[model samples]
Target: MKSLRLYGKQDLRYEEADNPVIENTDDVIVKVKAVGICGSDISRYKKLGPYVEGMVFGHEFAGEVTEVGSGVEGIRPGDRVAACPTFYCGECESCKKGELSRCEKLTVIGARHPGAYAEYVKLPAENILPLPDNVDYDTAAMVEPSSVVAHGFYRTSIKPGAEVAIMGCGSIGLLAVQWAKIFGAKKVYAIDIDDAKLEVAKEVGADVLINSMEKPAHEQIMDHTNGSGVDLAVESAGSPITSAQVFALPKKGGEVVFMGIPYADINIERFYFEKIVRSELTVLGSWNAISSPFPGKEWTSSVHYMSTGQINVKPMISHRLQLSEGPETFDNLINRKGSYVKVLFYPELD
Candidate 1:
């Protein structure tokens, strides 16, 4: 099997590796059909130090089941499925509480375990979700990241007719904009430094777009909300700068959700104090989804959303290449060249 492996800072190479086999009774081996590169993956490639070298690199994907372990039931060979990237031990306290994202034994596929960047991937049968008959492999590959945006919205308790301000227009931010609209937010303002991304934001139904680099993002958001600020602000840019912007854009009593991962040293004091002084702002951080919480509903609903044409992800896929082009794709993603939105790799392609 061929897989893309990280060697060091700005180093990625396509190499041959041993094909994965079922390791547990609950494990399943999937023949990869499609996989998407993520912002975190690019961050790792830039020497962020979270991803270890020589590890397979990809997490969001969908494929066909080639084999299933003995303990796997309700799923079998030939079933098309999307994978949940997070691996969790079902016996942990957080897992018991339906918080798999916070499980003590949580391990992300691309980050901790061998990931889906290869021709074959081994996952726990529990992590595989069936794809709807109408969904294609590319759209199904989006389910993992879409689920992350869904989890963030779930944490915010956003209601219809509420106003929203989203910072950043990257994959997660753009997806957040769509989810906010679908969830019935009355006015969703998308803020970003890139005009190209802002254009995509409009296509995804953002009510307003602000080039934060061109104007004051906070003031623009306030002006859009009738000088009251938005009811909910989601920070998806993953920067200390945007993190601060979230506090400035939410109304005194509004809610702010941090969907982006900031550096450990980023300061939150000003935002924390603002939350206390102004309208009682609820600051929430959402992680991955707990697939067990809804029993059989998690993957089904996400797939149905795609299958039914409710969520348009095709427009989000900007680049597709063979697995061997992994190095070039990594470079483009890190340098922010081209019009790349989401990059997919076909392992079987030569």
Candidate 2:
């Protein structure tokens, strides 16, 4: 078996590794088919710490079940599936309330344990979900990240015919564009620093594309909305600047949802901070997509949308590479070297 392991910051090595087996009676082993390189994965690869060498770190993955444990039911060795990757203790107060993301004993795959960036990975049977027969492995793997965007919508009060603005056009932000349109936004304004990403944003569903680097997003949205601003603003960039922009982009009495995780402390300007109070803006913070129902309704709805062709994940895919290209892909992602949108990995390829 071959796997990519992180030795240090920006240090990834593809080497031979032991094959995973069924570890628990409720666990199943999956042959890795497809997995995605997430933006956070690139950030962690460049950060100073939080590095764990010898770990296969990839949570957005899907594959065929190669082995099923004795206690597993309804799923077999040949079932094609994608996993939630959220491991939680059912005894925790948060878990008892069905908020697994807030569970005190939550362990996310790829972050805390070995993930699917290998030939095979072991997971609890309950976490494994069967993909529809029509969905391909690449799209099935995307359900994990897509669910994150879906959960972002759940935290908002966006209604049909409302004007929406999404800060940042990264993977999550671009997906947010699609979900906003699907969930009933009359118009969507996508803001990003990259022109290439803005183009993709337009293709997905963005009615207005504003290059924040070239001009202020708030200014553009105000001009387009006749100075009224958007009804909903979603902050998905997770930066101090983008977060502040989201705060100022909404109209009076509008709602702002922060979905991005800020890497550094954000200092909001006094004027921008006052906008929340003066405009009576509803400010909300959304963490990892967990609701009052375990894995949450977002996951189920994401799968349903993709399986039914109501949402398209193919256009978001920028590159598909073999596991051997893991190191190169990480480098490309860090440097922003290519016009890449989403990168997928196929472990079966050499």
Candidate 3:
């Protein structure tokens, strides 16, 4: 099998690797059809993450089942599916209370176990989810990222007819734009410095596009909202600047959800920090896309909406390559060489 492995920071190799096999009674092996690169993958590539040297490196994907263990039921070969790569220690306090995302030992496949960057990967039967007939391999590969955006929105108290401002236009931010509409927002604002991403956001149902390079994002948001600001604001840029700037985009007593992980220290200015106190805003932090009964409604709703043509990921996909291109792709991504949005890999492509 050919795979891209992480040797160290800025070191990704495309080489032959061992294929995964069913190791437990409930284990299952999947032949990778499509997989997408995540923002976290880029971050990890920039600086070493919690991964062993030369481990297969990827997570978001959808594929066909090739083998199943003796205890596996309701799942068999030839099933088209997407998987929840996350794992949780069920005995932890948070897990005992049905808060799986908050489990003390929560983790995903790519960090420790082998990932879906190659032709074959393995997971427990419970992590496998069958795809609907209408969902294709490309869309199914995006289910994990869509579920992540859905999880963040589910943590908010957004009501029908509410206005939303999403402070980013990356892949996660693009998904947030569509999720805002599905949550019944009257108007959805997409903010970013890049016109290309903002255009994609518009194509995916963003009602308004604001290029923050012209002015501060909140100022433009206020002008659009008649000086009132939005009912809900989402920070999905994962940049320290946007993380603080997001506080000022919501209305008084409105909600703010932090879905992006700022890997550096955040220093909020007085103007932005005061919004949290003077406006009595509700600030929330959302993590992985899992909940109570294992993978939860985030996964189910993401696939359902994708099947219905609501959560569209096609316009967000900027690059499509084979597994052999993994090394150079990661290099170009981190070196800022191309107009990359969302890159997907077709393992079957030679």
Best by lDDT: 3
The TM-score ranking, best first, is 3, 2, 1
lDDT comparing candidate 1 with the true structure: 0.83
The TM-score, computed over Cα atoms with residue i paired to residue i, of candidate 1 is 0.93
> How much does each candidate deviate from the true structure in C-alpha RMSD?
2.1, 1.6, 0.8
Give the per-residue Cα lDDT of candidate 1 at 319: 81
CA error at residue 233 for candidate 3, angstroms: 0.5
Candidates' lDDT values, in order? Answer: 0.83, 0.84, 0.93
Worst 10 residues of 1 by lDDT: 290-299
Q: List ranges where model 1 is wrong by over 4 Å.
A: 50-52, 267-276, 294-298
Kindly report which residue stretches of model 2 are placed more than 4 angstroms away from their true locations once superposed. 48-51
Model 2: lDDT equals 0.84
Candidate 3, residues 1-350: lDDT per residue as tens digits? 98888888888888888998777999999999999999999999997554788889899999999999999999999999999999898998999999999999988888888998999899999999999999999999999999999999999999999999999899999999999999999999999999999999999999999999999998899899889999999999999999999999999999999999878999999999999999999999999999878899999999999999999999999999999999899889988899999999998995
Task: Please give, for residues 1-350, the per-residue lDDT of candidate 2 as tens digits.
Answer: 98887777888889987888776889889998999987777777877423367787788899999998889999998889988887778888888877776779766677667877898988888788888988898888888778888887887888899999999988889888989988899999999998888989998879999998777888888889999999999998878788876878999999998878777888888878998999999998766665566577877887888888767788789899999999988887778777778899999997
